[model samples]
Target: MSMNDSWYRASVGDVTQRDALQGDITTDVCIVGAGFTGLSAALELAEAGVRVTVLEAEQVGWGCSGRNGGQINPGLGCDHGRVVAELGADDARKVWQLTLDGVELLRSRVKRHNIDCDLKAGILLVANKARHVPELQSWQHELEALGYDQLAFYDRDALQSLLKADYQAGVMDWGGGDLHPLKYALGLASAAEAAGAQILERSAVLGYEEDGRTVTIRTAAGQVHAQHLLLAGNAYLGKLLPWYRKGFMPIGSYVGATRPLGELATQLIPSRAAVCDMNTLIDYYRLSADNRLLFGGRASARDAQPNALRATMRERMALVFPALAEEDFEYLWGGQVAMTMSKAPVFGRLGRRTLFAQGYSGQGVALAGMAGKLMAQTVQGDAAGFDLMARAKHWPVPPGAPLQTAIRALALLWYRLQDSR
Candidate 1:
């Protein structure tokens, strides 16, 4: 296969296809990158009677959207306390509510569109270290103070009952869940197309020019002139826009799928909750609808696959479920996540008619799709919620790729050290 194959691709049934852009076209809104964010935005815009076009460099969900751990987490990549400290109580509350809105938006879309993506309904945030228990407690308390209380704390005993993992403690959030990400992406694309949106796969955006009135996007096959533009490509945007490159570091995250665990799957996670650890670089895993143990962790500044990727992942799995140490891992893949210095998503206008959202860190499964809806709302002249997210601070990455990589390595090393303690 030309692309890094994923278990998701193997398991999903037939996918919808749209022809590539053949000639120049005009649209009310033009979106680049047809992943969750772009498709979600396109669906909302098309439903509202707007002419929208989505350009994809690869197949829909070919990026991290399809390869993620499939955890539909509620909050941003950072902790709630950190959010309040950085964005302040008022703005932090607004952002928290946006996450809640994101979860609701996902649930509503899945139901309204009748999208069957194996949608599950719970996520367990477990502590990797005993020292992290107090931090988890603080997080639960903070969310409750903000009037959002869907979390149920779990002691070590409770965690062991549900997950045979070496976790210290955990909190289960009924508000969060997991799903088949690629199926969800395809479902959104289908819904968008059904609403009259045009999606052109294999149509990579070359560049664009916005003359205040309208933006003209040039691609290999065609050009698109639109009154507004949405750059939803995230880490895959590359150098298509120079300024955007400075806002986020594209880091590689790895995931693996095991052979079906059969009855052992239910025994491991009896409640069938998606689970993640609390370290800066954490381990996340869930049982697939087919009973495979899909586990993900490990990160790299470069795109190079880790030496012995499957072996390392299997070792990690053994730590969680020693009974499954011999379980055969059938799939190993990695994808880039756009991580910002602030660990908050970067959202704002490029000039006047151009808008973009990226740096979802590693929590893009739900938030990215919701951001697309927020982008659609912004295009419709409603920018309240979008602006709230755009208000979060972002620093430009240093000019050189080598320097940026080194800085990220140093920063991640420090985080790893902290996690070790």
Candidate 2:
């Protein structure tokens, strides 16, 4: 992967060109951060007749929400069985249904609002190690038990027809797909604004003070006084919520997009299905609507933006398909996602009248919408759904602070070692 400025800018076509912030505002809800989560919640709330104001530190989709791998995967980073094992089968079913609704909701929004972000269908979960076969089989059986026929197993022979060499097996899901995430975000923001929601760009929240009834959010341009507040900042929220910091440890993940491969790109991944190779620290990639290979992986907690990530990601992609070792790489952009220790996304109330959701790990494209939707539900006096997820306890990194990085570094080393053998 090459580190060029113009590398793989999503031919996302165009967006509504919404205006920036210029004055103070007051609304029923003040959402801090305009990524998928914030825009999503704003859309739902506004559509429900709730006045909402969204404040983005930068332009919409400028954060991880836009620059992610762009694979619209279903479910949490951890599987449904993990959810049941930790929670219960009943609650897990509700969670699974929401995950399915996430992708469906995205599709409906794209079609209903005419968001042309190159929406494509299908996502393949590939396994490189022989050890991954049983996991895929188990996942297939689990999904089947839940009456979900969306998943199909692929043996090495079947996988050969779709994926390039150096892979063992895979699980293909028909419902979930890939798209230009930035465009989807832009479309959602546009839709939210069109529905009478206030969206302000380049307006960072300086501070917030919450009383028992309402919260006051202070920003650079002005402030937002609202009955409730939603913090959708995710990995960007370093110490905004100190109590939940341990619940979500920000992990830096990098992605690389290749120059258009034309017919060859289509042939390499014949189905054009978004692919994620199974590993504790996995590698996920998909074809940009323009046919560029958008590959992503690796984990780092520190270093907001590493100087050079292209070569690092290139090596990872080359390991799976050496044929692309000589291809002209295009992009080396990376983003951060707040990963929970349990690998399940955390959503619930923080302080009274305040709602928060983060830590989708790498599965935010769909889950973030679900999180935002959940926020709407919570505000409406519906606590059943949110309570199930918020109950999952997140173990804090042992001594906290400086030791967290050292702990994650050790954990990454161990996981990579496990992946090697």
Candidate 3:
């Protein structure tokens, strides 16, 4: 397989490439990064009759938005109880509501825009080990106490009915689902463009200068001066925002798509729901519309060694379904997800006029889009939700990239060590 031959790209068919920014431009809002967050923000801003300009370093959805597990899983990367402990009751509830809004926002946008991304409803959190089942039970109790009844617990037998896997038990979340990520992203982009937003592909932001009044963003061939700016770049943000870089760690996750499994697909996951394990290093997967199994999981914090990634992912898949051992995976890809120290998203102002939302950890599919919506609202003079997010604290990473990488490596090693014993 080629380096970037992802299943999402292959399944989405041909995509029209947008031209890079070639000259100076001015807009009401300028957004850097054309992934889900950026495009979604542009959509909201454009719908409100605001002149929005979106600049992408690569094509739209070229980042983790295009390369995720496609699971519209709910909640923060951490447990709700942990959130309550850290943020206190009222703030935790508010933040939790934001995530729920994120899920609804995604569903409504897809419905209103008629996005054909093969969206299906249902997600199961399976336990790979018996000890994890009790943790899931605690999670269930916490959610139930919080009046969230969308989740239903399953014993090993009941779970087997939904998934023919070697899992101990599972919890089914009706609120979560899966979709064609790249297609959904492109659909958002199209909707934003139709609503009067200018989207420029391959137009990377070199730097920016923000005054209290207007912010000027410099690109290679052009510049954008806007009343407000958004940094929705997430893991790919790089050194663009030096101060913001330390707030999160860029961790790589890999995915592989198997050839169409025909009737076997239905049998593997009878409910056809997206599924993931409740582990620090999670294994998530869902069936494609054409019956391919899009399996994905965590890799190292660096660019993946394709052959090694494929082997490890395939081995993990086989553990869940021994029958797939002989199956051939046709596509393989990976992308980085930003993980904040607290495992919660970071949403705040760069200065006063520039707002940024990122560090969704691994659950960005729904939340990142919602974060975008919140950013749009802030630009429109409504900062209720955005302010709530900004209150969540974020810690800086170690200074240098090498030091950061070493820290992440040690963290992953510690997690893996715990998982082993």
Name the top TM-score candidate: 3
Q: Please list all clashing residue pairs in model 3, or write none if there are none.
A: 246-397
Candidate 3 yields a Cα-based lDDT of 0.88
TM-score of each prediction: 0.96, 0.94, 0.97
Full ranking by TM-score: 3, 1, 2
Residue 166's C-alpha lDDT in candidate 1?
Answer: 77
Ranking by lDDT: 3, 1, 2
Lowest-sum lDDT 10-residue window in model 1: 1-10
lDDT of each: 0.86, 0.80, 0.88
Candidate 2: residue 217 lDDT (0-100): 87
Instruction: Give a tens-digit lDDT track for model 2, residues 8-75.
Output: 34455444455566666678998888889999999999999999999887778877888787788778
**Alpha-carbon shift of residue 226 in model 3 (angstroms):** 0.6
After superposing candidate 3 on the true structure, give the runs of residues whose Cα lies further than 4 Å from its correct spot.
1-3
Q: After superposition, how far is residue 192 of candidate 1 from its true place, in Å?
A: 0.3
Q: Evaluated with lDDT, which candidate comes out highest? A: 3
> Which scores higher on TM-score, 2 or 3?
3
